[model samples]
Target: MSEPREQRAARFKAALMKSGARSDTSLYEHLVRLLSRVREEQPQDPVDVLEEMSRELKRGALQQDRGALRDVPATTPGQWLAEQQRALFSHARDEDEDDLVETPLPNLAEVAFFFQQAGVGLGGEEMQKVSLALRQLSDARPLRSCRFWGKVLGTEANYLVAECREAEPPGGAGGEGPGEGGDEDAAKMIVPPSTYKAPPVVPAEERGTGTNSSAYFVCREPGLPWTRLPDVVPAHITAARRIRKLFTGRLDAPVTSYPPFPGAEAEYLRAQIARISSGTQVSPLGFYHLQEEDEEEDEDEEQGTTRGRVEENPDFEPLPVTAMSKSLSAWVHHVPHILTQGRCVWVNPAEKPAAEPDEDEEEEEEPDEPEREEGPALFTPLSEDAEMDRLPPWSSRLSSALVPRFAVAYVRSNLWPGAHAYARGRKFQNVYIGWGVKSDAAFSPALPPDPQREFPGGPEVTEEADPTPQEERALRAAAEDKDETEDETEEDEDTE
Candidate 1:
């Protein structure tokens, strides 16, 4: 015969506590070990023992909370047991619900565009499911707000300009101030659209021919439009400003180019490339397109005479063609890949490498091997798969120009202390406007007029030559026909 269930449960509970099983996993292992020992000691059914132990534990719990249990009316044993089982199951279901994590949704427009471009077919139901998933993902994440500031250049129709420099504290002195600066500083910073000037022209001799060459003389001829943004701008703008600030004094600083607008710069580049490849023109806010038109001459005299005409049409401009020189094609193509796969390295300029000691100094120094000390690690070691899982998505990393906007925000908040405070207190805006074309002299001359072929005694006169025998015979026949036609017309008039 088996011992009383209460006695067995009390002994088991004591053993469980003694085993030091604090976590659920350890508790389960301990319970399994205890059951194995009980099986070895007796030939009794393990199921019956387990059931009895459960009942004993439940009774003990009820006894511990006897005061609370007494408040409820007593019921038949069968009904009470049923109610307890139902409650236990319901609690377990709730726990399961809490543990479940929902999947994120994708952007529907992007998804549709991708599928359409890839030539992939999707059924109606499948598309509906994808759209639903995208909705769920979008709903899960909050939207981020962005701000931009720069100048508009060229004819409003066909123009190319850069919107560099995010809004920053107005003054060069970095300190806390009256959040609002003087009106004069604000006036200087906020350049109106109509007043923005075209990019200043540096002579070719001064500008040099290097792609990474620094501007020797920035043409400051004021006429083009300029825009100034207030402090506390959008995340992307803050990132752009921070990056530009980082390279302030370094002449050989790395070139970090960002898109004029917000969001994934790679996506923008890809779309631009696709549009240009398809022969469809794209004109962003301040860029112009150069189109070639053919002019036709009088067809009767010169049947196939046509001349090539190159014209600038502000209304239709492709970004790649207008924004930068053709030499930047490689860089443009490489930008998307870097944004997706590259990681940023933060190096402190103040830190320098230690110099090597002389041979005499090395001989005088004492040799010592430091003893290794053992200590608990602060961070848990992660497997390769886990580390890969922790990495951000490509889209997220490349969502903004140069570096991700979030990374920039992090740098500002952590590395550049007081930057946030300074930005918040300042009322004035900082804007950097760059134009594509400075002056006619800055650019290479257009194709020179085709060299005219010189003939001896100037251009030959084809009409000066006398008519051939065949031509003369035809002319005489035409004259005789005209005379006959006139005579017939006169005869008809007389008969009438």
Candidate 2:
């Protein structure tokens, strides 16, 4: 038989006490109100209301371990590793007692920015380079650019070893030209310098008087930089737009500038542009001198240069003049598909929805239903909603939970690492966050803070509220009255 509401409440109160909730009357009254509401609305079954309350409290406690649900919970061993890897390689630090430094892995937009910076160019070239590089790198190493491995790869290592490769010669030979009917013929090609020989310079006066410099293309250093979008392009536009967009027209506005981008976004965009611009008749003078550090362990090692073995020769592929030219043709003809392939990864401008396919065609290519990797463990196909649900209600309640309009300076400070971890987990699921450290040890406690005076910004003080002057005065007067009354009572008792 079910107990009376009062009896059930009494049991819940005991459970709460056992679980470490404060036993103050105010808190008790608050819990009682909730219990009354739950009883009035939801009927109890095999599990009594008190039992339900206990279960909920337990869930709440577990949620705290789940980083208050702000953290992306590990779904699989691989994902857990990825989280660990990110945390290990993150640029953020923990300043609070909680010690959870949220460090998200670099994202595609950021990846694109790197590509753009590499002068691989954005659009078609970027797509091709990113995909080809990743595929090649994966073949070389199981998960070269996986989020966990991203930091290890570094900008130079990723570019040299994991980022996309240029079209190569047939026979997998570095300098040898392609043979007829070779893969090199189909391989995507970039512009060659010979195509754009500078015309014999005419007299300075003969130059057109109406100097109309096209903002579309600017001269750059040879290599990817020449052909690809500038790292400064996105920055320029972003800065320009930000300056215009966030303009309150107030001269004394706080933080008068759009925050500087870490150049990741620009790199990703450049890569994207390169990918989209692939196969186009690019000018070789359009060089993007991709700066790569010598990642070679010995003199024989060239960062991106692969070592051949019996199964896979360490030789480089060569491209033919004709094959390189054909890349331009393919780029022009397949422009639409190439442009839209994976531009969704861009951040400066968020991706627009893909146009609806024709009814008959839609039947031919049904949108692939999301498939969760089947396993004994709980593995859910990720979604914005699911990710949001993983966080505490307050954290996820903001319009832009990922990027809020304004955050507490403390939350913002704490969020840097958390954001890093969050973005990494969401974007790159395969990489470990702290790959070097054991998963359990990734978030281990750090050195204790030194003793210091209590202040507005102390870590110990979470939420601070100021009391009214009247309230402060009342407390002071009450203390004084109590002391005086105690003295008078003591004197009367002594006389008796």
Candidate 3:
């Protein structure tokens, strides 16, 4: 039999006290107090939570060491020296690990902005260089450009060394040429044009002049590495239309903007957005500062009268990105997927009713039953209700969750490292609201690309004039005399 209600309540109270909760009076009062305490304890936000977890895991790993290794005896001097070296190496590695306790995680909005900056040059020269490097690596050929390795590989140590032979003359006997089965050989050796076609160059004067500039091709064909649409159908137009609706006029706006709703609708949406963004069921409603009533209004109305009192706006104060709107929250969760998902579809409920036999047809069918086949059934059809039930809910079909998994995989395989590196190098300011460190540097807008400008972040190489033979000889004689004088001065100083 189940325990009595009073006994259960007492047990629960005792459990709470055991778990570091304080009780002042009755169990009911204790529960209310415990709930209030839990509500007050809002730990770090999602970004900081990830950072804290990472730090704790690292610290735990570092704390765990083999005590037995310390007690092990070395049989020879060389072995002892080797053991000492290993210990030193381990100590150095531990020292190199970062202490994340003092460092705070970056703001989500700043991270979004950094990603936006990285995606800007996807169809530019940077992408072309990356594509070229990919082709070389796939073909097991030596990379021709050191700059490519630096930009794409992050460091020279990451570059793979390959031994490739030089191609023979085109006209030589048994040599490949355009007319002599060279086309087939070329096709085998080179990357497909559809996979790596460079974006067309637009002249500065002609750019943003017409609709032609607006058109962009995400993929050459509608299949894997692009869209999951059938070969006969065009996916680009459908994908573009859905994506336009998904984002609308929201991407360019800051998260602080209030939802265009009054009263309860705004409050409900805000609460939902907050819950989804933080991945938590319960959160504080946030603090509100009540405004004082006007003296004239107070005088007009009797004391304790609410007649002629103005109602305060529920959403007058601005909220952070985490508590903004559902659209923004969904975007944060699925940014990488959103960028690559070529097409999306929303399933509409069927309007037409299931077909029923007519009166005459029913009468005719009753006249005689057809002979049943003896073999096993090839296929079975589901009932109308069952089929309908199997379909996903309308909400799940929204762009947020409808993005194909393949698109995300493609992005991770192709674009992740470069984008990550780019974002990692830049500074993330305003980490916690308008708080944290203040920088002295003035912000300057990035300039549009110009061919005449020097290569970015690279030193200019200038050719120096060569010295004549007479000048070279004179310089050598001066260097020798200077060395001799320095030696004599050193000898004099020693004597003194």
Candidate 4:
């Protein structure tokens, strides 16, 4: 006996209807792939085969979702897994953050708590999320130090930036140091060019406010990956100053605006972070002192730059927060202004090298010469706050400029728009909250004052001249007489 096709179809339908099961897209795709494999193998036990396939698919997806731990060598499995666990968003704790090393991390929770008084603080829940994100970042990467850079709000979404000091790359900055070369035959003898066509400025100390001083990472959401932003090139910084647009929150989004930018949103964001930090990041007067001379030869040699760095002042006496909050000059800008050519230090290429004066002669004339200019102080005073649309550019106050213990200085910058900073004693915190926009010189579009009118006599002043009845009659009589005189003169000319 043989079964007909119609009979087989009827039997399958009856069984499917009785089971009352619905197949979704995920299940359908899985089954389709499984059936293809089964048909190829002509499996003996389909049930056992399906179970094995399911396990394999699950394992592959797990690896894709939770990334493979970075920087883990072929070591103990348990230990590596533990490290992966630490490098997750949930590793953050309620207490303050601390590194196993002595480097003290900025406490975001406390900053949020203190800055709330100024009305610019990111709320408690958001700050907690940021803490978790930062914790995961520090654990994931080989970081020497990391801190919360401010939040930049975007139209579609927002970016929470993390500033980090990364471990130096292998082979050092120049690729391989002199010692790394194998032998005389293997190594190539090289020397720097005697001079450059356009010689670069002497770069400032690496640890201070140099170009791309620290690494910056941005993330839209706490669960999302922390993307290391591209470095800010000079051209990008110059362009960013001219154009002002809100971040789209997409790293690869094209910048379709005027004075076309080179890269994408990542480049634009990096330039903005540099500008904001330079303008609003400040500290108390003596909080940071400039290093007059190089101290350690090892660090100077490693970085390959002369030392004109900024260091923490260990012996700084606490300034009264009440007095400090009364004026803007009490604080000083720690970051250097990005010059027009997009550099911190300017270089004069035309000047030739000069011979050094004798030590004895220099000492003899030291008392006679005028005081020298120390190329823009490592820390300069914050400029006077200006007024915008009648409102002050900066609002400074203390929780109570009276109480010493609770007195914390809070200054909100209107120039950079939503930048805020708070200082108590030694510890200080700064954060930004609005869209990344620097305030324009004028709030509304300015048209020239209708241009001054061409009036020479200051202004044309006219008064309504009134006439009495007598004056009106006299004017009418004069008009009639003038008409008669004109008629007589015309007749005389015709007769002649």
Best by TM-score: 4
Lowest lDDT block of 10, candidate 4: 171-180
Candidate 4 lDDT by residue in tens digits, 96-139: 55454344356777877778765666778767877777877876
Q: Give me the runs in candidate 1 sitting further than 4 Å from their true place.
A: 1-58, 61-118, 121-126, 130-496
lDDT of 3 by residue, 1-496 (tens): 9899999998887766552222223445444644454457556464455455445544544433445336666479556544543422222345433542222222323433443443422334333333333332323322221111111121111111111122221222211111222356767886645534332221111111111111111111111021111111112221221221111111122223122211121122222122111121111122122244576566524432222212233664433322221212121111001111111111111223358858776443222332322211111111111112243111101112243321111011011112221212113111111101112133233444555654456345655679999999999999999999999999999999
lDDT of 3: 0.27
Over the stretch 117-200, how does candidate 2's per-residue lDDT look in tens digits?
Answer: 223223554344433333323333322122211111122112221222222212221111112234675456674544333322
What is the lDDT ranking, best to worst? Answer: 4, 2, 1, 3
* Root-mean-square deviation of Cα positions for candidate 1 versus the true structure, in angstroms: 35.4
Scored by CA lDDT, what does every candidate get?
0.29, 0.29, 0.27, 0.69
Candidate 2 Cα deviation (angstroms), residue 365: 42
Off by over 4 Å in 2: 1-81, 84-163, 166-496
Each candidate's root-mean-square deviation in Å? 35.4, 36.3, 40.7, 19.7
lDDT (10s digit) by residue, model 1, range 361-435: 655443343332222111111111111224311110111244322211100111111111000011111121222
Regions of model 4 farther than 4 Å from truth: 1-104, 169-209, 295-306, 348-376, 383-393, 401-405, 442-496
